[model samples]
Target: MKEVRFFYAPEATITEELPQDEATHAIRVLRLQSGDEIFFMDGKGAFHRAEITLVTNKKCMYRIVETMQQEPTWRGHIHLAIAPTKMMDRVEWMVEKATEIGFDEISFLNCRFSERTKIRTDRIEKIVVSAVKQSHKAWKPIVNEMLDFKNFICQPREGRKFICHCYEEVSKEDFFSLISSVSQEESLHESDDITVLVGPEGDFSIDEVRMALDNGYESVTLGKSRLRTETAGLQAVSMSNLARRI
Candidate 1:
């Protein structure tokens, strides 16, 4: 059996040529020829098994042989709102790993102690696409531009909401415990969309935590040890993903 190369074609149809970027990779990098088989994903849970029909310097066309639509990996959407780290590589790494683990959306937060205030969603989104293709996941995660902490927490979100922080004065509960309790209570529904807020290196200010609590975000802890901004974000993603499974 030939190794099936997967290309992201969000607007793919039963009979159409691959997009320019995909075409370039298919024809130039992979050296795929006419009659070769490949798979295409629309990043909306649809996969198209296709056979290459034309290969040129600028175009790689295909005809769909079969279509498969996949179901969600777990119930509910996992949305992670995080403060971007000072190092761009760390943020990129988190996005790549999180996409592989499966999540619905990611948002950047501008917090009181954030090292980086601006985020380029365009660059991070490319990471998302690459990770989705490499993982062969049917769905692609949305990466949003950075937003102020107030704006994000104020936005109405459905399902459960949480904020992870490290402060001695603030009362907090273990994240896993809260997940178990919430799951038991809402077991009938597939799963409720979960939104988790992770703060920066210095953590959310006591005042900021107060604001989030006022706006319905429950304070939770990842564990005993403190975590960096990106690590905390990744951990929140892992915990949220695990919560839906229980």
Candidate 2:
């Protein structure tokens, strides 16, 4: 299995020395020696194979020897617009797990029900990076800055739009049910991207849901259970992936 590779975010192409933490971890923690083969495929969808050429107590350098591109040319993209939980740790966990399950975008919406008004981009980015490596996924999820719910509803986008809001008397379809239906409409064996919104702990406000509905967003449901924000997002992702597989 080519020893599943590792990649540096900045592509090891800078003139300056590697960051202290990165250097130390690559050398001291992973313990690579000169002449050992490895790869640092940049996150920009390119792969580079190399052999360790320089080694210090701090960092080990690799000489690029081979290059290739792997699978998943994005005809599909999972964009999850979500409300950040009051507990930032839960938000972190959501980013990490969602990346592992293959998400393309993490959008933060400051809705009426939102408990946390701010999101730390750096911390969330770290979680995405760790998840990409942990899950052996070549693609990382893009975590966007927080935006107001009303503003998000006005943003223009192409293709099918879905809003998963649990509301009474609104036409709601189970996420799995919708996934199955959407999959059946197209080539299931191939990828198809869709965006989903997971509301806050207090859930999406009635006004927020109304605005989304008025703007042509179809209402969808995860299931009978009222899930926490993160759980609902993952459930939707998992359902989409499974449906695509079918």
Candidate 3:
């Protein structure tokens, strides 16, 4: 038996030819030839099984055999907003892992104590695409540009909102416990979109935490152990995915 491989192609159905990047991988790297069976993900909750009709020097064209609309593994939207670390590789790793874990969206925060204020969302998008393909996820996570902490908190959002900080001054709830309790009360049919905010290495400034609280974001703790920025982001996504698992 042969293993099935999936490729990222946002316009898979609209266009018969694979995107440049995907075409290069299929034709050159994978050495795929005419009449080969392949699968494509449109990154919008659909998967297409196709047969390669033509392969040229730079293009791989295919005809769709079947189209499948997939349901997500987890219910609701799981969004993670975090302050990027000074080292970009850490942030990239978190995005990759989170996408594999099946999150809906990710946003970067420019906090008061943020070590790295600038972010290249294009680079992060590529990482997300690769992860989605590898994980065989039907939906692609949205990668938003970095926003100031103050502005991000002020933005109107739906569902449950939380801010994770290591502040003893503020009363904090255990995130996992809260999520579990909520799940027990409501039926699985009810979907609650959740957004979790995590700060940088130094954590969110007390003032920033207060601002978030003022904007109706709950203060929460991941666990007893202190975690790095990247780890905290991954943990938040993981917990949300598990709680919302269907």
Candidate 2: pairs in clash? none
Q: Which ten residues in a row have the lowest lDDT in candidate 2?
A: 9-18
| Poorest lDDT segment (10 consecutive residues) of candidate 1 | 182-191
The alpha-carbon deviation from the true structure for residue 168 of candidate 2, after best TM-score superposition, in angstroms, is 1.1
Q: Which pairs of residues collide in candidate 3? A: none
Instruction: State each model's CA lDDT, in order.
Output: 0.88, 0.74, 0.92
Model 2: how far is 176 from its true place, Å?
Answer: 2.3
lDDT tens digits by residue: candidate 3, 1-246: 136689999988889999999999999899999999999899999999999999999999999999999987897889999999999999999999999888999999999899999999999999999999988889999999999999999998877899999999999999988776774557555547899999999999999999999998999999998899999999999999998888
* Selected candidate, larger TM-score, 1 vs 2: 1
Q: Which ranking of candidates, highest TM-score first?
A: 3, 1, 2
Query: Model 1 off-target regions past 4 Å?
Result: 1-3, 183-185, 189-191
Candidate achieving higher TM-score, 2 or 3: 3
Task: List TM-score per model, in order.
Answer: 0.93, 0.86, 0.95
Question: lDDT by residue for model 1 over 38-147, one digit each (tens)?
Answer: 99899999889989998877999889889999878777889999999989999999999999888899999999999999988999989999999988889999889899
Instruction: Flag clash pairs in model 1.
Output: none
lDDT, model 3, position 82: 96
Error at 134, model 1, angstroms: 0.9
